[model samples]
Target: METLETTKLDLTGKIDVVENISREDFLEFYMKPQKPVIIKHLYGKDAQVYKWTFDYFQKELGELEVGVFDDESETRQDDRSYKKAPMTMKFGEYLQIIQEKPTSKRLFLFNVFKHKKELLNHFKFPNIADNVLSFLPFAFFGGQGAETRIHRDMDNSCVFLTEIAGYKRVVLFDPKYSKLLYQYPYSTHTSIDVNHPDFDKYPGLAHVQGIDCTIGPGDTIFMPSGWWHHIEYNTAGLGFAIRSLSPHYKDRVVGILQVGLKTHIDDLANKILGSKWFDWKKNKTIERANRAIQKLQKK
Candidate 1:
């Protein structure tokens, strides 16, 4: 019998981990090349890692309401359903429900800015990321069995997401596999549900390779631009992400436009036109890809 772990094949090999590496080495090997790597010691000799706990957050921002999505990600038909009308709860209230008593309804209720600022003091600027990191960090938190759908991030930027609390399993696919994964017509999210992928419905995913990495407290994983990924919360934990501009200036400019403007416009278009628009785009995408393959084959 096949389990969730064995459902997909992992062929990218293990990601490299470097400890006490120089800035120049990082730039040459990982940053400039835009390959993923795990830096074992992002914080050098700092005892402050112990201070980033749920208890500390509760004490810091008492009674503050944060935006969260309580809906189960797996149950929702579309990824944006939760975002269409967000559910919110107080920070303290969320922490209680998230850890001791978690539900199928996923909760993403962190005070985005407030929590980010407080946690910023924990780590020094990394040479691997350098000044390329954009401001206002992103965080995701949930209990055991919680997960994110298989998808690329909205922005075409490099991401360094660090685990602060419990274990998280990040299953990654190179951007090249997007065609095989059956991506959403107008969104960055893929059509395949990581927890329960319907292989019959998504025949394109056959033989596609994935890479899995599990991170614990104080561990960070670097994800390059457009890398397709799915995240599973193995236990109740808090994770922080810092997205940096792509090394290429053109890529950075494009990312800024897409994240800041294109997403809203696309979402609005999707809403107005509905299923017809989506169906046409999906068919056209497959046709275009097939034509490209045929051209390459004849060459």
Candidate 2:
């Protein structure tokens, strides 16, 4: 296997860690400011972390059918997080696959509790944020070494992601640096590989600053709305995220447009133009990134 080059960028900014925080303080300090924070005690004492192991899931919800996503792209060279899942399998089989060996298979944006409502009894939702999308609680599962490429959620909502099992390394960038990250046209993600960034090809990445964090079981990380994140599963793990609306109304409007307008437009264009549309977006990403670099130089 080819060794990954050491990352050229330095993420000097720190992701705050707190043992505990009040709902009001979390709002004023972290949420309002759009800062990322890892809360160690957010889940409350009664939360059942031990019961969330892979064996338990496999035993209880094993027969549930699920869409499994992987790091493969058919239309382009870039493997994207938002790519449509290519296959489906029994939830138990996938869990067994990951448990036995490292694999690229990932279970993305699934609500397992929807199939078995009794699963919700394992944990209590934190009351730190308002308008918690209780009905939309989603779960993400990944095997060792599986990576979710750099991307932002299209819904543009604040995400409180709780690590249920194993460990995950996360790299985050504020949305303000979207152009520097070479965000593709009409997409919520960048094709740039954060693990071993090609500085020569994507020079704008060297100028970008970000936060790096690793979370273990029971830790909840607050991801601000529209933040770009790259996630790597250090070990096969499961994470649950409860999303809430962005505090700002304008951001909510953008989220609506992203899902209701931008997604459909991209799909239509891709279907009509095929590979030509991808080529255009790839070239446009470079052009826009160069402009962003030039603007930074002028300042």
Candidate number with greatest lDDT: 2
Error of 2 at 268 (Å): 0.7
* Candidate 2 residue spans exceeding 4 A from truth: 1-7, 72-83
Listed per model in order, the count of residue pairs whose N, CA or C atoms clash below 3 Å is 0, 0
Task: State the number of backbone clashes in model 1.
Answer: 0
What TM-score would every model get versus the actual structure? Answer: 0.84, 0.93
Error of 1 at 141 (Å): 1.7
* Tens-digit lDDT track of model 1 for 69-181: 54453346553424532566777877777778655434442335564475666666566556565455766777777777676776678888878888888888877766667
Residue 153 lDDT in candidate 1: 74
Decoy 1 TM-score against native: 0.84
* lDDT scores in order: 0.68, 0.83
Mark the regions of model 1 whose C-alpha exceeds 4 Å error after superposition.
Answer: 1-7, 45-47, 73-85, 104-118, 288-299
